[model samples]
Target: MAPKEKDDKPIKINKWEGAAVKNALDDAVKEVLTKKFNYVENFALMDGRLVICGIAVGVAMFALVWDYLYPFPQSRPILIFSVTTYFIMMGILTLYTTYKEKGIFAVCIQKDSSKKENVWEASSYLPKYDDKYNLILALIDGKTRQRRETSIKKSVANYIDVNGSVVNELVEAEVTKMHNSLLSERKEK
Candidate 1:
């Protein structure tokens, strides 16, 4: 359970629960680690596709060995084997050409009624968080944007809009690609 606030004073988070808090923190850390693992897995998948393609070609190219081994001897079996391996390898290697990618995204908006200015910041490209997700940052005006995180001054409110499911693959992509995210804050009027 979430720690309850004391009646008369500000809740002292550390004074109450220790193990519970630690467990919560540990869970959160594990969640993030899982995300990172997903990212690496996607990277590895992309890498593996390339490697498979290479191996397929390597197998087919070795078919030429049949000619060398057949000096004056009729190695019909070798020739047929090499040709079959080459065709099968080429067919399998060609499949890598068709592949797709995806990622997750979050949006944050900040606003203050008193001011006319707003900020659009993404979860990615924040300089401190360029990689690990896909971030698209844009400086927007008073007008609305198609899809973006808007922050107005003073409210200090928080809003998160997460898009897409957890992709346990492309963990190491630029944060903006692996996930789409935005953060913005606004002040109270």
Candidate 2:
């Protein structure tokens, strides 16, 4: 008997199924991000930095005006101190914000609505950490909104790891549950 050739054809899925899969993958990624990595999408740090900058600017302006009006040696020192304080605060804010932003790990799975392609485009932004596997995964959708979720188990396993191992068991379970629920919903409709 002749050896059977493996089929290399891609599976054809409708737009509805593709959307469902994309949604499930997105949800799974969000779960992994929040549960395993403990990443929350909050602007508290940025807001705090802005508030501090405002205070520094106000102090510097007050010192400058005081020195201009009083013209005293003591007031000059206060002006210098306020100006120096503002610069130092700005430098610290820049450095800390850059460090924190670079440390964030992110992943995105988007469907190209412009094109009629069925493939869901996936991309990941992993932080450069000392450990290769210690990464935080965040899934962003087409709208560019940062959705806090878990990692994609099978759909994005290759993107996360080269060994094809499941990223997280919890993520895998969640993905399976979502997929099953989606399928059941489709059957009921």
Candidate 3:
């Protein structure tokens, strides 16, 4: 007897059901926390802002004291220029920070590369309600690394929910149906 060859076809394992879903969701949340809410980056920006503000304050105070002490006519223009430049720089930094943060949140979802046959990619929008996330899950072909299907569940763990929880139910059912439909469509072709 000849040995059987292994199938190279991608397999879809249900990562979005039972306790597994919790783990997947936790991983997604962790990614968001680590990448989007990065403490080090935040601290650095905040420190920069504080330093700029302090410099502005120090300059203003020095100018006030100097003017009161000596009353130089030329000092006012120099003080104004320095203070205005500091404020403008601070504003630019603030705008850049805001744009950077928004960009992070805008593309929060990332691909999952743990498996070789089928991959589960997950993303979420900013929580609209306290402790509730709007999650989007995609099933990707590991070989092609392309998204085959997607499922959106809004307000996970919502009070008086319509969409239902992310765990132990919704995603698996939806994905399975999609998988079956795809299989059937392929067979027909």
Candidate 4:
């Protein structure tokens, strides 16, 4: 049976029951950690070559529209100024956002002299997030283990205080249960 909270409380939480609570907390923490890693992965995606290309195209279109709608005193000077400014801003944004780059991008070019045809293919540039993902998972596991150990220690101490030497078997059983739970989790992985 779970130990009573005290004279003032109504319900009691035994060691086994406390495991359920800890399991829920563990799941929530794991979800949060996974979500953090997902956010990092999304950030990595945002700095891709495709996004840069899209930004360049968008800025060019905006410049064209601005020039068309409002004619400056000199068309050539205004166009040159806006285009240069846009490219400078794009370069700054790219530097700020894309700090790290991993993996190689391959481009293939094929030319036929007789047919006078050329084909160009480019590989996608995507960041590799496997290391970060694995590190996050390991952190989640470490945090979960730490939380469970502290909770079990507190429960065992309380049980000992309440029942003295008689609760030794219960403590042993609880330890065994914790060991089994960790083993099962490792097996799942």
Best by TM-score: 2
lDDT score at residue 8, model 4, on the 0-100 scale: 29
List TM-score per model, in order.
Answer: 0.30, 0.34, 0.32, 0.26
lDDT (C-alpha, whole model) for all candidates: 0.36, 0.46, 0.46, 0.38
- Summarize candidate 1's per-residue lDDT along 1-189 as a digit string, tens digits: 877654223112231233332232222222333344232112443465577767766665665665666652576666677668777766664554343211112222335364644433222211221212223333334445434442212110111112211222222232333233232221211
Residue 147, model 1: lDDT of 45
lDDT of 3 by residue, 1-189 (tens): 766653222222243233333344544343343444331112443455567678767767877887777677867776777678778867866775576332122222223355454433344443423344454544445456555544445433431223322332344444345445544543464
**TM-score of model 3 vs. true structure:** 0.32
Q: Tens-digit lDDT track for model 4 on 1-189?
A: 888754323223342333433332233232332332221112343346566766677777877887788776546676787688678868865675455332112111223335432221111121232111111111113222321111132332332333222233343354345444543654566
The worst-scoring run of ten residues by lDDT in candidate 4 lies at: 130-139
Given candidate 4, what's the lDDT at residue 160? 32
Q: Once model 2 is optimally superposed onto the true structure by TM-score, how far is the C-alpha of residue 35 displaced, in angstroms?
A: 22
TM-score of 1: 0.30
Ranking by TM-score: 2, 3, 1, 4
Q: What is the lDDT of residue 104 in candidate 3?
A: 26
Clashes of each: 35, 11, 0, 0
